[model samples]
Target: MSSTPAPAPAPAPAPVPAPAIADRPPPTFRQKAGFFAMIFGMFMAILDVQIVASSLADIQAGLSASIEEISWVQTSYLIAEVVMIPLSGTLARILSTRVLFSLAALGFTVMSFACSLATSLEAMILARSLQGFFAGAMIPSIFSTAYTMFPRRSMGKVSVVIGLVATMGPTIGPTLGGFITQALGWHWLFNINIIPGLIVAATVWSCIDIDQPEPAYLRGLDVSGLVALATALGTLNYVLEEGPRNDWFEDQTIFRLAVLSAASGCVFFWRAFTYRQPIVDLRAFSDRNFALGCFFSFVVGIGLFGSVYMTPLFLAQVRDYNALDIGIIMMVTGAFQFSVAPLVGTLSGRMDLRLMLAFGFSLFCFALYLNSFLTAESSYWEFFVPQAVRGVSLMFCFVPVNRLALGTLAPDKLKNGAGLYNLMRNLGGALGLAVINTLLVERGAHHLSYLSENLTLSRPEVQAYIDRLAERLGDSLAGGVAGDPELAAMKLLFQLAQREALVMSFNDCLLLIGLTFGAALIVMPLVKKPRD
Candidate 1:
């Protein structure tokens, strides 16, 4: 240091600074509030779609809608949803996600109020169409915004939240709708939405924040693609919604829709490949995982929605269980899902997701198989056990399988992937409902015919029944207790037999779901491993 101070000890080289980790913005108290509020909107919207499901009789009477017109209440909403799902991303880009979410909530609320006040079937239909348009925005926007708000590390947690909301809709919808319809009337189903929806809308508007709007150097709208997609979706939906009632292609309009639907679907896929920006990004399917994800989502949607639809119908109509009983049974299943979903999400990183999903499907299939044996005599306890078990299976499949589905996908593909996943779910559900309803009708007719023929009044046993009826009526074979106990007994017998036949039909249909589930087991091996 004395030798010219050793050049000041060679001055310590400037210490290199530690690299800074990108601090993820904290999930603000407001964002958190908004997230749950939007969830409330989602639950309300879903409940609206289904709650009225149990109150169709009352809705028709109140609005004076014919059965065909009554169907539009559900069909219009479903069609509007399908049409808007693919458009959600484009619309999001066009409008602020937060504003869109708020407007969606607002639109839904206003429409609900309007639908409540609708004086005629025509008015109700129009209100519902607008309601459909509004509601179509809620889910896709929520899903899109969720990806933006939550980091990758927190997705599992988010999934749990979304899953709970998803499961609860079916659980509480019919129960709430039934209580309100019984206590108040069908208009209350729509009216009840007003307060909750407005509250949700206000909360979301206050809390959800999006960046300032960018200039709209908008992408082309892909008009042809939109038309084709709409055609395919609309036609297919019509067929699905109407097929069971119209008896498939036997109806002229249905036949036309079937052809148009097929043609449009084929053309849409063909056009998609040729277009720069397709309505649906067909290239999403290029990712092996995403494509399979779509498949799984669709099939699972069928399982999920079909089971939800069938179980309640069987309980209320076939088994003669009340709305509360059906809700309780659904709650049992939903509770199981709530409990198990997080565990699956937690274990996903350690486990092979394909295996988990396979196991889930296997469990669901087993549950359905158990359910397949349902009869008019089956109790809710018998039903609840299997559904609860199915809940565990759905938990395994829904979250972990989703983890694998998107694990390999890039961020860029998320919007399309999510929307497609949702759309496929609804489509699968529509298909499942149509198939099951048709099967229910056909099976009922076939089985009823077979049973009725075998157990017909033509037998001596039936003659004895007639003789007994004549004695019970306190008029005898002298005039046969209505001058023809044979005809009266046969009429009474047919009525009784038809009810029994319908009961059998519904049970047989439930069993058929089990058969479909068994087929899913074979497809399990087709699943791929998550990317390392």
Candidate 2:
């Protein structure tokens, strides 16, 4: 009778809990060194993107490149880098982080040295393209490694380090370039990376062992998808970079490239969804947070690179400040960014991330609004407050943006997600620069025409202003020039009008960017709170 009694069902198996933050082992010393080395390598890569920007004139003169051609130095790097960024995820899975990053660092180093030695514009462009392609791998690798290597509790500190470098590299780029060009020469801009690049390559190769190479993925390599992706991004970057300069669709080359980019992009997306193992894993976007996070990244890029592009340009054009002077003024943003990072790191841990994002974006918007008030006479002190605000706000924006975007992704998805995330920021910057350039040209002309229409010789104030200018120039005029005082005064008046119009255009651009951040704040509530 006892044997006939039904056996009690076994208790349901206890749920297997995830490893706790404390339970997870801390990063080994080698991992720490390797991560930092990758960070530095990323800094060098991103830094190079803008390093030659302030010193482009010097590079132009050194290489005897025409103004139109000189632009390609930067453009080539951007195009090549954009193509490489998304593809890096697939490359990493095949080659592993150790081989991919070390090779990239080494290749980047070699290309940098080649760039330093380039005597012709063609050679320089080739070297820079290779350099940028190599550099692109380093950026996403740092991001992927950060999420995968560390415990959730440590993300705050990791975010600060990565965010500071991601931002500071570009923020301080013009400053460092100006200083280097003034002190040594333009060649040293590339030369400075040699020792550091070698060290990064050596250190990463020796220390990094995060993921083993998935050789199986190589068997299913999406070559067609890779080509399609490259073509789409490459052509798209070209169109954005050259569209404003060439009158958008008015230019035959831009129009053709735009069509090609659209076609290729369609194919790339098609392959992405249909392929067994696509070059990029598009499934990451299925996560609501990741999708929104990318849009935020794109908008943040507009503010970050857009501000960096505009400020120095304003200082140079309106104030007649030299490269060194502009660099000094720009230093305020970098200084505040560096100083506030630790505070942000601490606050990130204690506060709600979504709230932190709102605060950061709000302050950034405020800073941009301040910048929208800039006049032609505005100088260092005028820029100081806005730059400081922007610097602090950026720390807030970047930290939260990084966490919110990549935090919820599974460890397996982090690599691809990071690539897509970074790609949006870069694309945003490219698009922002194009729009800013177009606005400057159109808006500047509009303001100039309006001013010209208002100021006529018939107006008493205009006559009086011309009279004073003529009188001032009378003493400086000699011989035939003396009879043309009125003409000289007219020329000077035109110059003044042009300067004021350009400043107004800059103000308009700043206002638009500020409004963009405000818009971003409205969407913050949609991001799901990330799991710890």
- TM-scores for all candidates: the values are 0.87, 0.95
lDDT of model 2 at position 435? 93
Per-residue lDDT tens digits for candidate 2, residues 1-21, read: 233223222111111212443
- Candidate 2 least-lDDT 10 residues: 8-17
How big is the RMSD of model 2? 7.2
Model 2, position 40, has a per-residue lDDT of: 97
> In model 1, which regions exceed 4 Å deviation?
1-26, 209-219, 456-487
The prediction achieving the highest TM-score against the true structure is 2
lDDT of model number 1: 0.73
**Highest lDDT among the candidates is held by which one?**
2
For residue 314, what is the lDDT in candidate 1? 77
lDDT (C-alpha) at residue 357 in model 2:
90
**What's the lDDT for all of these models?**
0.73, 0.90
